[model samples]
Target chain A: MSGKGGVGKSTVTACLADGLTRLGVSTGVLDADLNGPCMARMMGVKDHKPSSQNGAMIAARNAYGVPVMSMDMFLPEDETPLVWEAPSQQGAYTWRSMVEMSALRELLSDTDWGDLDVLLIDLPPGAERFQNLADLLPDLTGAVVVSTASQTAMTVVSRSISMALNIAEVEVVGLVENMSTMVCPECGYKDRVFIGVETVEELARRHGVPYLGAIPFNVGLADFLETGRSYIEMHAEHPAAHAILEVAQRVHFWLKNQSK
Target chain B: MALKSTHGPFDGSMSIVYECPTCSMQTAMLTNRAETQMVRSLGVKIGGRTAPEEPMETLRSNLASGQEVSPERPAPSTGGKCPFTGMVNDAIGAAESEPEKPVWTEGALARIEAIPGYIQPMVKRNVENFALEHGCFEIDEDVMDAVRGRLGI
Candidate 1:
């Protein structure tokens, strides 16, 4: 998952993980936010630290039933505002991003991922300096582009997709439009909050990529999300959960068929 | 991202980060410490040198923030004007002619040798300053010639 910062990348990633779990597929989520990770916070398990086993660190499972590890989990709860210089920051990047990527590879290779169907990699928002994962690991499966309906986000998303395709040579599986519409929980009236903006479907169509459909904005989902509860399990009838499940099913089908 | 500094990589020794904002194209110091620090910090494999634009005002502000000022001296107008830039290099030359500061030992000489070719000149200049302040030693003429050639002085 990739896009510019603050564009619902983590939310979509959470939904995807939740969807995969609902389908009875054991999924492992790796939060590759090297410098400053927020996945642990999003998963509401920032305090749950992982322990070391032999030379390697064991992955921490969140309350939401996803195996996750991130720099935030290791740091203090109030350490968010601390400014880290390049050197100290490098230690985190090496341990959290690069080494974590290596650990994921070893997990897939050495460990018996019994009955595991998919591994979801939750990447950072922007494709900045530390976003060279494809170069570091050549065995990266194709990625899904997460974007909002904003014009600037669409531009960055386009560049990110193009970059993954051309430079990284990773296939662009699809584009998921997050926060497409906000519906009133009381009246059930849907309002195009981000009206007149190009959705991910439009972006995919323009770039000759597959449009993976849109996710509705819901506050109940947000509350569940903030409280680290599984949205699909809590609100099975929610529009956002259904949309994400459909996308996840399509992704699973595509990946499975490609293996054949 | 521990920097795997083998010999083959650019090592940022020969590659200098030049701030060519003005016509003079002033050179910025890409010290071994700075280069390795940046590489580790960024954590990406930089095949070659990459130049980022820096403003003079920003640099000056940084110097001021550290309570350090450029040594106050006129540039060496050996002729009436600077033969190179024609703007006064006199500021730097004048500072050079003043009483030498106490020398640090050749403690960092071996370290400098590990650096790439292009940056050797600055290290040589530092060594020359140290030697002159302590006591000048005559050894190899070829090395002196190479230093002069590289520095174009």
Candidate 2:
């Protein structure tokens, strides 16, 4: 999934993996966001360490037995920050990008994923990394873009979609609107969180991609984040979980049609 | 070719004349030590040695007489060992000495073929690696099932 930062790309990735697994599809996730990797924690494999076998790193499994590989697994502690060793910090910018690319390459190639039907790579924000990933995985199936209802996120996410369709020349599976609306937990009332210039459905129509679905901003999801719980698993009947599962179903049908 | 003035000599700059081994096309450029080191670091070999330093009068006279004068410092010997070449040789040697990839039985190949083309490569590679790790020289349906069992899928 590719999108602007804070648009819930990681959250959507976790939910999709969970939903896909529940649908009986073998799915895995590669947390490509090196700087801000939260998949390990979100997938409830934060404390698991990846073991090496025959020069390939074994992926960590979540509670559902879904393999996950992320830079967060290599971190020593939650508070420990990721830092690259360099000769000097004066001009680290020039080489830091290359180092990050190399790290991503190693993660993709040197990990023993053990055969997965779907490997959802959770890309960090920005269109550049999408281009890098496209270059790395030539046969990339497609990209799923996530965006919030805010105009700022829409503006940035539109550019990302353009980069995927125009520059990367890959198919955009669909667009999923995250936090499209907020539901009042007290009274069960729905309201728009951001009064934007355009709705996500209009943006998807403009780009000519499928509008997967919209996930409501649920307080339960936020609490699950703090508790390291799978919201989709626990609250499968909730509107937010139902929307995400529908998106996953659409993606599965799309993949089935694509394979044919 | 004409000698182009690039950077100053104080920064370890020197005039280099490169003669192509194939076409004998001579090219001249003024480059500094920093640039040479940078190029060498990228695994490119720079030809020609630097000429010894001479008096300004002698240099001027040599230029006037159309006599080629070398730069102040000699370029390192092209015969010297290149770290890049050594690295490439080591990689090639490692590959040559490595064990052969395990063979996939017809049944196993058919099972892999049943997978989608996009993910077939990954699935095949993972299964083969798994087979190798388990000391299996031939991958069949049993090996495939074992991989699934190991992954608990």
Candidate 3:
């Protein structure tokens, strides 16, 4: 949601959605990444398209009945590119076109979303989109920031997280460090392919944000997504899945505590 | 809207505008420092994989019900001048100092392309413009626009 692009926001989102569903909690994954929506493919529901009902946009329901809507669904084809400029466009288009195309307002208001226990909005990367979401819906609950352990990623993400907290005035729930390391299944050896995990936790603690957990760099996830089935469902014992479920439980319980 | 109280303890509502002349990209951050921090804090929750349900849900629902969701009206300005000197500083000051080096990845362009629709085009254009301005590559508009459009720009 609050991380730079390609930092695995969608993967984490999918896992949490699956985790919640596994708990019998009704959930909806709203893709607000209007400029580029790929949740359909990541969720293994690439062919599902959103429909309209009684002037309200209908979200595409996954096999598990989780309602999903994204820009990818409306795109003519996966290969076609979106070339519109950020500040300039013609014929009822603007940077706002991206948000409007997502039908974010309608999706939130009109859809049956059917008494959702949780609705995860997959916001685009960077501060600008999140800032727009802030202006569009100011009092919406807090945000989660994603970061890699690299210093550059941390620096940019720090500014982003600061903007979310300081400029948007939203509560920061926690931090998730993705691409931490890869653990060899056969040898039980942990490899630090990218930056070490400590950097992320240190940054989170320094900024006073909760350090949730890390997702190791796993090639299996790519294969898992291709099959349209979550690794958790198949490899419940996978360390990566275990880490994800840990964060999911913490997130669930944290939300419950916030309500109280 | 009338220029609201510019004098005294500056609230976290100052507007900032940035113009990158080399590539012709200008953006503004209208809200103040405090608000940015708040948003970033909320982003932690967002990035951490949790949703803020109660307050946000209620606010969104109210807007859905056609309620006017504007904040309380700002106070009228007294036409205050800059306390520093009588001469008003109308123009935005110097841009934030450039970082010592580029922060973007070398393969950022290819990475953007892998994303679903139009985003690739959009980000690619910005990157090209950035590269041209910094002298990383030569500028060729006809070729650039075409390449940019390929990204769906």
Candidate 4:
């Protein structure tokens, strides 16, 4: 899953992994968002280190038994937001991007992911940065682009979809319109809280991509999500959880079709 | 939904999020750093880097309303000026200073020229960048192949 920053890409990723795991599907969550790898904290494995065996790295399994790997796992306590300066010979080409790309490549290839039904890679949001991983994983089933139900988010997400389809040359499976509405659990009042030029369905239709439903605002989600607990497990009966599960099902069906 | 982001991703006015690590700066599309704290207070981690402290009210007002932050610094320039078009260019790549230009063999120059005119400058710059990166003075078929692979052209 990938999209512009602050698009709930990580939350969606964690939920997918959690949902997929519950369905008896072997899953792996790859935290490809090198700069700000929220997966570690979100997966409730912030300090979980990937064990080095022989010369290869082994991904750490989270509480849900979902094997997870992130750039954060490789860093020491003090070093966060890995700052690596590219040499002068390399056109100020953010050496950190290249380094993180290499690290991601190594993580994807070298890590003993072991046979899994799917490996959900949570990617950083950007055209060029996301494109860096394009050559590494050419056989991607498709990308699930995430965005909030807002014009600014959609604009950046539009670029993400274009890059995935054109530059990265990856199939865009669908778009997730997050924060579609905030429902008052007490009064059952619905409010379209975020500012969006058009509905997410309209945005998807305009882009010629599949419109995977939207995730509503859960009043408890703010504090609940910070707990690092899987959303599906925490709020199995919540409307938000239902939406995520449905999205996961669509992704599964899409993957199955791609395999066929 | 719960994990607050400094200034929601969409403000109907912003499109590009700037992530500058060195200066510990980050701007999301229309969101500026002045509101970084308010965004953080909203429980949204703005960037991996900590934002330098500023007035809370300004940040609060900006985050609350998605208004443009005051006294905002202008964005960084592209710096990549085109040699042929003279417009800001990324295709042309780093301009070659006299001391830095690698010596291209006659065969390599011929090979480079043989490429279509429209793409020659880009290919030449890419090849030069590749050569400079690898510290290769000579452009053999192997070097040419490496450059092609590196540039994916």
Worst 10 residues of 4 chain A by lDDT: A85-94
Q: Looking at model 1 chain A, which ten-residue stretch has the lowest summed lDDT?
A: A81-90
Candidate 4 lDDT by residue in tens digits, A161-225: 88888888888889887778898878988888686568778878888989887888766664555
Tell me chain A's TM-score in each of the predictions.
0.83, 0.95, 0.88, 0.89
Give the CAPRI class of candidate 3.
incorrect
Q: What TM-score does chain A of model 2 get? A: 0.95
Per-residue accuracy of model 3 over A178-239 as CA lDDT, tens digit each: 87888887998997756644598898888898888888888878657645665777888888
TM-score of each: 0.58, 0.65, 0.59, 0.59
DockQ of each: 0.02, 0.01, 0.03, 0.01
Clashing pairs in 2: B50-B75, B51-B70, B51-B71
Of 1 and 2, the candidate ranking higher by lDDT: 2
Best candidate (score: TM-score): 2
| Better lDDT candidate (1, 3) | 3
Task: Kindly report which residue stretches of model 1 are placed more than 4 angstroms away from their true locations once superposed.
Answer: A81-116, A129-131, B1-31, B35-153
lDDT of 4 by residue, B18-129 (tens): 4565664665434332242223223232222133322222222222111122321212224323221111111111221122567878877888877655445446756765
